[model samples]
Structures are given as structure tokens and as C-alpha cells.
Target chain A: MNDSAGKIKLPTTILMIVAGVFMILPFLWMISTSFQSPSEVFSKWLPSKLDWSSHERIWTGSYNFVPYYLNSVKISVISTIGAVFLSALAAYGFARIEFKGRDAMFLVYLSMMMIPPQVIFVPKFIMFNWMHIYNTHWALILPGMFSIFGVFMLRQFFMSVPKEITESAFLDGAGHFKIFFRLVLPLAKPALATFAIIDFSWHWNDYENALVFLTSPELYTIPLGLQNFILENNVDYNGMMAASSAAIIPMILIFLIGQKYIIQGISSSAVKG
Target chain B: MKRRSWIQKQGWIGYAFIMPNMLGILLFFIIPALFSFGLMFTDYQFANPNVSFTGLDNIERLFQDEQFYSAVRHTGIFLLSVPISLVIAFIVALVLNRSVYLKGLLRGMFFLPYISSGVAVAFVWMLLFQPSHGPINEVLRWIGIATPPGWFADSDTAMYAIDVVQIWFMLGYNMIIYLAALQEISAEQLEAARIDGASARTVTWKIVWPLVSPTTFLLLITGLIMTMKSFSLIQAITQGGPSGSTTILSLFVYKTAFSYYEMGYASAISWFLFAVILIITIIQWIGQKRWVHY
Candidate 1:
């Protein structure tokens, strides 16, 4: 029996290693292709000639990706901050304060999750066009600031906090805003971090909305910029791969930095629901 | 009396906090969704909004449209792939659920594809499936096959290629969700089954499978909705090409509105897709009572 169990372990170990390799292969290919010259990129094995010129061109040339990176960073940071702050406040309201239509309003917020974004794509485009925000960063940032998911997630976290703490703060003559900022915000750190990471990654990688709204090349986010890159330089596989690799760097950084919170956030939500 | 006023003030403040989002949804989401339903009945065009009202003309045309039928067929094919992918994800999740070294690293590696933009991954797959220089055909050549089908270029194979890419991208995410569900199952139940001399397969079928049905159901419903609406990957990879063989409903809506400038027709297509998904979701919700353990 022991021998049989040991035999099973050996195959499982081998299978895991194989699965790991399969999972990492694309990332490895992305990095490998990015460093290759035009001639060597499509080669059967790894690139023979390692050329880093594409990376330099992306950073320093006329159509530099620095602007795209900056646009992504600026939009993601502002929107994430905006979303966290506003959602936390709303969450506190929904979790703690009772008012008319409170349950009904919460249901409305939850129902938004089921409504496909495609349903609103055309009208929202028209709306944005009318407002003259179609081609600006405001188009991207403003809509994201009012995310329902963040509100709902944060509300769940806030509800779990002890009521005694809020009562104590109230007794100390702290107003709602003061308690929200000073007391509740600090306590909801894990939830806040979780939503921030999610929002950042989502906005950073968002392509469809960016594709539709940002018509101008100057306002192009990284995903849009990368798609434009592919359109213009479809034959230059090396350059395209390099651009793609660069675009994914920030997401990897986010995942690494907030790995714990992301896991906790997802698992907690899954179990609770 | 002072405390009552404070409570009222706090309630108002709460409303203030949620007001921005509520207003945005009312303006942007709720209003547009209702307007889209209205647009379905009209011949709306961005260039000619005044001559918009067509009175169910677009919906009538949708039934007769050959491309719409083709899109439906393609969507059906895509939906068929979802179950296969989910099963693969479930198997992988079960394998990974066991205690293993480098588990976090493995999980992250699997999840990398999910986080990256679908367009980027589609581009990589496009290169790897390129007719001449791609390694896929190279491997096929080594396996004693004289000639391999051109993956995305062949009309017969393009939808299948798109399905393969979609499955690869989604498998990791589904696996993670399943892993989470698997962990929630109590160890005592499994131990009891083990002591009763049940085989692993029997234990899984009778115990773990029933327990994880809710997660499975959730994955199924969400996966169906998502797959039905998938456009970006299809656009990036196939462009619904090789004689429009890979065009699903979402891409059809996009092409109809943007490429062909048939806003009313696209709106009709969108409504059709929405109704189909709504029916499926309702069925699943009703069926959940029977199958979903939770």
C-alpha cells in the first residue's frame, strides 16, 4: 500500500511540472520573442540573436510608448483612488445607515452586475459624444469611478466590522465623514487593497471601452496603443511582441505586490456568497 | 431629539456617498439599456437619427438574415466548447488541490493568461499558429502528418481554433474558482468515504462533485454569458474571417453597427443575443434548484 501511494505521487509530480511549463510557456515566449530580431523571432526554438533594439525604440523613438504608459498609469491611479474613496463611503452607508428604499437600492446595485455592458455600449457612446468627453481621459476615468462591484464588495466588508466601534466614534462627537475617513477606512484596508488591485488591473487592461471612446491617437491607453501597433506593424512581429510584453509589465507588478490581498478577496467573496 | 437629528443626518450623508454611482447608473446604464430596447424598434443611424423609427423592421430583418443564422451557429459551437473547457479546468483544479510544493507559483503561472489582455494572448496564438513559421505546424510535421490544416485561415477550422484559444485563456480562471470551492469541502467527509473503502473516482462522484455543484453551476452560467458576448478575442485573432465563419452574435452586432453602419440592425442583433442569454440564465436558475447542492 505504501509503495502504491509512493508510485501515485511520482506521476502527480511529473504531471504538475508539465502543467507548470504549459502555463508559463506563453509568458516565456512573450519575453523571448520581444528580445529577438525580425529574422529570429519565428524560429523553431528560442531566438539565436538577442536584439534589445525594439525595447529602446519603444521607449525613445518618435512613436514612443512612454506616453501610452503614462496615460495608463495616470488613468488607473486616479480612477482607482476615486473608486476606492467613493465606494467605501457608499459601502458604509449601505452597511450601517438605514434609510428609505435601502434594500431596494442595494438590489439595484447588485442587479447592475448582471446587466451586460454591451447593452449600454451604443447609447453610452452617443452620450459621451454629446458630452464632448468621447476622446478624452475623462471618458475612461469618470465611468470607472462609479463601479458597482467596488461598492458591493466594500459594503460586505464594512458590514462585518463591529457596530460598537462606530457607536464609540459617534459618542466621541465625530461626524460621519470623520468616522468614515479615520475609523472605517483604516479598518477596511484589506478590502480597499483588494478592490484597488482589481480596479487597476481592469482599467489598465481594458480594451473595448478604450477602443470605442478614445478615437485620438494621443489619448490611446496601452491596450489601444498596442492594438494600433499591431495594425501598423503586423509584419514586424518582434516589435509587436516587445510592445505587448511592455504593456503586461505593470499587471505583473500589480499581481506580485497585491497577491495576498487578491487571493484573500476572491476566496472570501466566494465563500461568503 | 439631538440624537434623532444626528441619525437623520447620517442617513442623508449615506445617500450622498452613494449618489454619484446611483446617478451614473441611472444616466449611463439604466437609461441606455432602455433606449437600446427602444432602438431595436427604430431604424436608428448615427448619420441619420431623424429617420430612425422603422417599427420592428430591424427585428423582422434579423430573422431572415443569413449572417445572423451563421452567427447563431458559431455561437452554438462556442457554447459547446465551454463544457469541455470546464471539465478540463475541473480536472486541473482537482490535481492542484492536493498539497504540493511551489503551489503559489503554479497558481500564479496558470492565472497569468487570465490577467493579460485577451488581445495580447490572441496575438501570441496568431503567431504560433501562423501557416509557415509557426511551431504548431512544425510539431504536426514531426508527428508524420504530411500536411496540417491552416488553423485560422481555413473556414472549417477557424472557429475551432478560436475555441481552442478561448479554452486555454479561460481554463486557469475556472480552475482557480473550482480550487476555492474544493477547499471548502470538509476533510471529515472524505476520510469517512476513504474508511468505507471507496475508490477515488467513486468518492469524487458521490461526495466532491455533488458538493461543488453550485460552483460548477455558477461557472456554467457565467461562462455561457461571457462566451456568448465574446468579441475582442475573435476580432483580434480571426476578425470573424475565412469567409465569416467565426462571426458570433457579439461580433455581428459590432460589424453591423460600426462596419456596415446598420445601427438599428445591430440593435436588433444585440436584443436577440440578450434574449437568448436571458432564457439560458433563467433555465439555469430554475435548474439550480434540482442540481445545485447549495
Candidate 2:
């Protein structure tokens, strides 16, 4: 029995290690390829000559990646702020307020989640054109501000807040706004943080909508810029890989920092839904 | 009476909170949906924004469009691949659920592909599927299978190749969801089965499997909808392929609007795809009531 148990452990351990390595391979390749020279990218093994120059080039204005990175950071920051603020307020209203058509209206918002964004891209483009917000930062920020998932998830969190706290605040002559800002908002920190991290990561990595909407080079998000870089040039595999690797750093850092909240947020929301 | 008036007054504030999102949905979602439907009836072209309406012409052209037919075939192939990937994910989740060591780390490892930028993931797979000197071909050679088919380059295998990448990218996400569901299963129930001398296979089939069926059903329906909308990886990896063999409907619509400059026809196709997804979702919803076990 002891021997069999020990044998079982050995294969499971090996299987886990194999799976771990497979999962990390692409990321490892991305980093390795980024550090390779133009000639060494396609080599079977790690690059023979590791070049640190690409990293320097990206940072020190030699490479044109600064603008792309700046654009991504700007857009992600603005969108995250917008989404968190508006969604939180809306969530509070949905959870706390007993208004007419509230359930029906909330259902309308929830149903929007099922409609694939691709279906709306063309008409959105037309609308943006008419509004003259087509290729601007407003294009990215405005639409993202009113996230349906955000409102839904936050409403779930808000509902779980004991009703007594808000009711007491109301009894103490606090207005609805005061009760929300002072009592409910402070209590919902973890949920807000979770939403912020998710929204940041999503906007940072967003490619498809950004690709269709942003036509100008200056306005291009990281993924869009990276794709354009690949398409316009001869396969600069090293440069492309370098840019891609650089792009994911912020995401990795954000994930590591807020991973606990994000995991909790996802699981709790998933179970509830 | 004053307090009641105050409550009525705050109703507008609720609207205020929801106003931005409402405006966005109105402008970006609702209006776009309407325009897309209307575009189906007009000759909306980027080249000539002033083009006149052509009722049913675009929809009529869709019937004879060979590319559309091929795209339908490719989408069917993609739908077939979803179940295979889901099964792999489900099995992986079950194994991980039983194991004691480094489960979180292992879960994160699998989920890496899902979180990574789709473009970057596609690029990595593109390199992996390179006709020569790719690790995949290298492995194939080691197995004494010389000259494996050029995966994304060969028209016949292009869609299948894209499906493989899609499966790899999606495996961790679905597995994580399944893992979460698996964790909810009662340990006491499992222990009871163990005491009764039920084998692990029987325990799993009889106890764990039934409990997880609802999750499995949900994953199936969600996976189908998501796979139908999958275009980015295909766009990046194959660009609808050597001979449009990998041209699923989403990509077909994209090419129609952007490449072929036929927005009206693309809108029609988009609506058609939407209708298909809606129908499938409804069917799955009804079917789940019968077989999902929850």
C-alpha cells in the first residue's frame, strides 16, 4: 500500500510539472524571443546571443514603443476610472432603490451582456462618426464607462450589505446620496477594487474594438499598434516579440497585485450568477 | 408627505447613476443594432457614403455567395471542435481536483493562455505551427512521421489547425470553471461512497459526474456561442487561410466589411450569425431543463 501510494505521487508530480511547463512555454518563448537578435528568433533552442539592447531601445526613445505603451496606460487608466465610478453608483442604485421598472430595466442591462460586441461595431462606428468621437480617447473611454458586467456584479455585492446599516443612516437624517457615499461605498471596497483591476486588465488587453475604432497611429492601443507593426514591416520577429513581452508586464504586475480580489470577485460572481 | 416627495425626488438620482451607461448602450449598442439591420437594406459603402438604398439585393446576393457557404462549413467544423476541447478541459479539471499539491499554481498555469492578449497568443501558435523548424513538426519528425502537413498553410487542414489553437487557449478557462464546480461537491458524500467500497470510477460516474452536469451544460452553451464569435485568433493565425478554408462567419463578415468593402452584405451576414446563435442558445436552454441534472 505504501509503495503504491508513493508510486501514485510520482506520476502526479511529474504530470503537474509537465503541465506547468507547457503553460509557461509561450510566455517563456515571448521573453526569450524578445531578447533575441533579428537573426536568432527562429532558432530551435534559446537564442545563442542574448541581446539586452532591445530593452534599452524600447525605454530610451530609440524604439517607437513608448507612444504605444503610453497610449495603453492612458486608455486603461481612464477607462478603469470611468467604469468603476459609474458602475458602482449604478449598482448602488439598482441594489438600494425601490423604483418602478427597476427589475425590468436591470434585465435589459443584463440582456445586453449576451449581445456580442461585434454585432454593434458597425452601427457604433456610424454613431461615433456622427458624434465626431470616432478616433479620439473618448471613443475608448466613454463606451467602457457603462459596463453591464460591472453594474451587475457590483449590484450583487451591494445587495449582500446588511440593510440595517443603510436604514440606520436614513433614520439618522442622512440623504440617499450621503448614505450611499458614506456607508455603502466604504463597505464595498473589496468589490470596487476587484472591478477596478478587472476593468484595467480588460481595457489594457482590448484589441478587437480598438482595432476597428481607432484608425490613427497616435491613438492606437498596444495590441493594435503591435499588430500594425507586424503587418507593415518585414517580419521583425525580435522587435515584435520585444513589444509583446513589454506589453504584458503591466498586466502581470496588476494580476500579481490584485489576484486575491480578482479570484474572489470572479468566483463569488460566478456562483451568484 | 414631504418624505415621500423626497423619495420620488431621488428616483431621478437613480437615473443619474445609470444615465452614462444608458447613453452608451443607446448610442453604441441599440443604435448600432438598428443601423446594422438597416444597413442590410442599403448599399452602405465606405468609398461612397452617399450610395443609394438597394432593398433585399444584399440578402439576395448572400444566397449565391460561395464564400458564405464555405464560411458556414468552417463554422460547423469549429462547433465540432468545441466539445472535444471542453472534454479535455473537464478531464483535466477532474484530475487537478483530486490532487493535493500546487493546485492553485497549476490552475494559474493553465489559465495563462486565456488572459494573455489574443494577438500574442496567436503569434506564439503561429510560430509553433510553422511548416518547418516548428516544435510541433520537430516532434512529429521524432515520431518517424516525416513532413507533417503545413498546418495553417494547407487549405484542407487550416481550419482544424485554428481549432487546435482555440482549444489550447480555451482549455485553462473552462477547466478553472469546472474546478470551481468540482470544489463544491460534498466531501462527506465522497467518503460515504468510499466506505461502501465503490471504485473511484464508479464514485465519479455515480456521484461527482451528476453534480457537475449543470456546469458542463452551461460550459457547452457558452462555449458554442463564444466559438461562433471567435475571429481574432483566426484573423491573426490564418488570415482566413491560404484559400479561405478557415473563413468562419465572423471573419467572413469582417472581410466583407473591411476587405471586400461590402458593409451591407456583411451586416446581413452578421444578423444571420446572430440569429443562429440565438436559436442554438434557446435550444440548449430547453435541452438543459431535461438533461442538465441541476
**Which candidate number maximizes TM-score?**
1
The residue pairs that clash in candidate 1, if any, are none
Candidate 1 lDDT, A105-136, residue by residue in tens:
98887666666666667777778889989889
Q: Can you give the DockQ of every candidate in the order shown?
A: 0.50, 0.47
Query: Following a full C-alpha superposition, what root-mean-square deviation does model 2 have from the true structure?
Result: 2.8
Residue-level lDDT tens digits of model 2 in B1-294:
755754675666777767776786676677778778899898888767587789999888988998889899999998876788778888888878775367777777777676665676677777777787767787798899987989998998888888888888778778877888888988888888888998878988888888988887887888888889868888877789888899899988888887877788888888888888888778876987887776
Q: How many steric clashes does model 1 contain?
A: 0
lDDT of 2 by residue, A81-178 (tens): 98898888888889887677878888788666666666777777777888999888788888877788899899999999998787667767787789
- Those runs of model 1 whose alpha carbons end farther than 4 Å from true positions after fitting are A1-7, A171-173, B1-10
lDDT by residue (tens digit), candidate 1, B7-60:
675656667767876887687668888878888888778777585578978878
Q: Any residue pairs clashing in model 2, and if so which?
A: none
- Docking band of candidate 1: medium
Best prediction by DockQ: 1
